[model samples]
Target: MSHSSPASSASAAPASIACTSLDYVWPDGTTVFDGLQVSFGPGRSGLVGVNGSGKSTLLKLIAGELRPSGGTVRVTGEIGYLPQNVTLDTALRVEDVLGIAGTRAALHAIEAGDVREEHFAAVGDDWDVEERATAALAGLGLGHVGLDRTTGELSGGESVLLRLAALLMRRPDILLLDEPTNNLDLYARRRLYAAVEAWNGVMVVVSHDRELLERVDQIADLRGGEVAWYGGGFSAYEEALAVEQEAAERMVRVAESDLRKQKRELSDAHVKLARRKRYGQKMWDNKREPKVVMGERKRQAQVSAGKHRIMHEEKLAEARERLDKAAEAVRDDDEIRVDLPHTAVPPGRSVLTLRELRLRHGARVDGEFELRGPERIALVGRNGAGKTTLLRTLAGELDAVSGTADVHVPLRFLPQRLDLLDDELTVVGNVARFAPEATPNEIRARLARFLFRGARAGQRAGTLSGGERFRATLAALMLAEPAPQLLLLDEPTNNLDLASVRQLTTALESYEGALIVASHDLRFLESVGVTRWLRLDGGLRDTTAEEVRAEMAGEG
Candidate 1:
């Protein structure tokens, strides 16, 4: 890939992007990047960072979706951009999104004996636009979707894949995707993974999806207003980061020790100077020495003390600054730490049961389905397979089309939309709404564990970012009035940062309750200790994560 020679290689590549002295600031006066110099050459690069790290903003700038506050972005070839939040008009057809609607309409018109010059112009030389569009859609696991299907007919995951297919049909030289797999199911994500793997042109993806990042040729870590390049994928990046963090920590310790030593030396110098002054004063007061001799001695002592004091003070200041720099190098990866003993369920207690369950979105449980004990279940399926419908039914937020979904324990559901929290209230007030009996102090103490401490807990829910809102909603659900013994989380990891996902995993570690979370996040499912894998396709069936991965890879 010649990452070392980005200048030469990127210039020659048909698809490339270069950002020179780039700067961006939000409308609210929050600075994201300043004088950021970055370039992308041929081959895939995974752009990763913490939430609000400007990865997406950089992509937008490159794609010309946004104008940089300062600096310039240069790009070669046509760009295909799939933003993090995709909004398509539901009234549009598949061909419209794939940008072949005009050509298709023109072809059909000519076939109907209206051989107009306008039709010929619209068709151009692309008589096979329909074929190409179909192939693109099929390549992304949308083969079953017809060209006439409305955008409203597709699920969220399908829509994302459709957008990708649209981009592919354009045959753009450069592709920029921001969190492309946010709502994708395991199967849909596999299609994305394959697409990313097959990308030969320049591609820069901003994603937290582990599997997707693993497919990239390189990793560009955006941090502290600059980008650092790693030669390999996510695993290699992690290893490199671990090594760097370890060294940074060591440097911090050394700097701290040096600062302490300097402080002590400064203190000791003060004490010694004071002692000398006392002795000199005694000599002067008692008239034990000649006046001229005493005066000269005192002057010498004052000069020497002043020099020593200044030297010691300067050394201390330098040490403190060094210590601060060293500390800055160390990353702050705070995790959620909480215990939910009240949510614990006994070993053999029944949590939830479904009988002949038929969801509104075309999913059905074949027979009596029972979840007993503190079972951690991963509900896997394709989009529109009724995962949300099932979760909502169990939470009593929606009634089943026809069947019984009984919840024997006090349960709480974290919906995919995260619409449970009131926008007007603060995080404290939101959680307080769920735990009405709990005092404000008690609620604040619990919220602190979710990384909402002090004034942060008072931040309004509406003002919270995607990651913060996820945590706040989670906190509310986990700390509800009765304390959910059975939890229903629908894509809980969606739009969450890596740290927030880890926080969720940590929080789940302390939870001793039954859990049925419908998510396609393979790493997340593994991390949270999924006890069972239930594939809710035509009917509920037991499956394994490996099996699903194999199926997605076309191996099964």
Candidate 2:
């Protein structure tokens, strides 16, 4: 599914990181990893798992950001880590973020004929530090950015890359990147992929981006507090998982059948023993043999019956254990399901139109454009290109600066903020607010498909995790009254794990409506069945998926 080539990380004999009998527990007594053992060698490894399966937690432990509750992490050299949510002082310059401000300052002092012992020491072996810094930034598509530029001036995506550029500058023996492509545009992601391919040291990336995963040398799937290694990239890992799941399912079926047979055999043995007891009693009453002989025979029969029952019971217990083990091998990754038939639009129905539209954010759509039928449009652009502003205008949340925007059908907008739900309300209560006509039972039933089953549906919105909050907000939007025929989603896949992204796609699959989704994730767009590609640079222009791919490749 990825257009990018596999990242062939330069082979090197780098230091390895080993976590022996690692154990970590939260202050609230929630255990994340207990006696977990894993190791990473020099190469690019894609660390993957379902949301909250401790992918990020494990990375933090490796980076020494979090300490294990009971075990030790042994590393051979320095480690560079780019966390998922990167926050830096806006006042800091680009050089500061790259960790070369002091070196550069020292080099400048020496060049200015003001060299002192401290200055010379500071400039040790880093006389070309500035040059290397600029080249590293350039390699990551940050060449045009001045080292003196303030961090606040860069967009969200740029900030992420700048941080990575800093890590690259350090040249650590091990590098850890968490969701590196979360906010990156096509160009930045391509550059990041290039950097990943060029890395010769130990590297482990925790990302849901399929393209990023596809470039890795191998995959380390962390689930249930353990790591499972798969050679090759994301595609190979998926194929292997499919085969494994199939075998696990077959074992489950066999186990169940064996359990049933054991139970039946046990029941038959009980019936036979009861019949023998009755026959022995009849013989005793009829005086068919001496009292002593009848008593001895009865005693022997009871002893044999007890042993027979014990054997069958043990077999049944063993079968039950097998069934449990088999079931554990099968994954229960949750998926979102919806039936929005009412949201469907006819092929000839008009959906959305923009006429000489000019958004308040300074992005303009030239002339007139109309969306007909249930077209799935992928709105793509660089950061700060006003994709979100366009979606806001479509959703009627923002008045256009000029021109007119009209929606010809019921519509819903899911913004990147995900602030639609009220924290005071429970999951079911929030959905009920959106669909007042829907009964409480109906709402609960639908929420189950969103993976909020039973008590989970009763959980307050404020208590939801990142993935859960996204699902709750999405449920409220898609299940609203007068069902949305035109959905405008801005960066829907951002911050979502791979499973949640698939869940979003699953929900979209059931939505028979027009969709305009703004996202930088290529695989996600393809998964959601995007029919049209709209690139919003200075102007909203029509493009193709292949063209987008070509741009990413061509620019690279």
Name the TM-score of candidate 2.
0.86
Enumerate residue pairs that collide in model 1. none
Candidate 1, superposed: residue stretches over 4 Å from native: 1-31, 34-37, 61-76, 285-289, 338-341, 421-445, 453-463, 552-554
Worst 10 residues of 1 by lDDT: 1-10
Candidate 2, 192-282: lDDT as tens digits? 9989999998999998888888999999999899999999999999999999999999999999999999999999999999998899889
Q: After best superposition, candidate 2 residue 195: deviation in angstroms?
A: 1.2
Which structure among the candidates has the greatest TM-score?
1
The lDDT for every candidate, in the order shown, is 0.86, 0.85
Candidate 2, position 83, lDDT = 92
For residues 1-556, write the lDDT of model 1, one tens digit per residue.
Answer: 0111123454355777888888888664657878899999899999988765777778878887778888888877678999877778999998889988888999999999998899999999999888888889889899999999999888878899999999998877889999899889867788889899998989999888888888999999998889899988999999999999999999999999999999999999999999999999999999998999999999999999999999999999999999899988889966666555467789989888889988876778978999999999999888878788788888898888898988898888888878899999989999988989889998998889878998889888876756677788888877777778888899888777788788778878778999898988877889999999998887989999899778767687
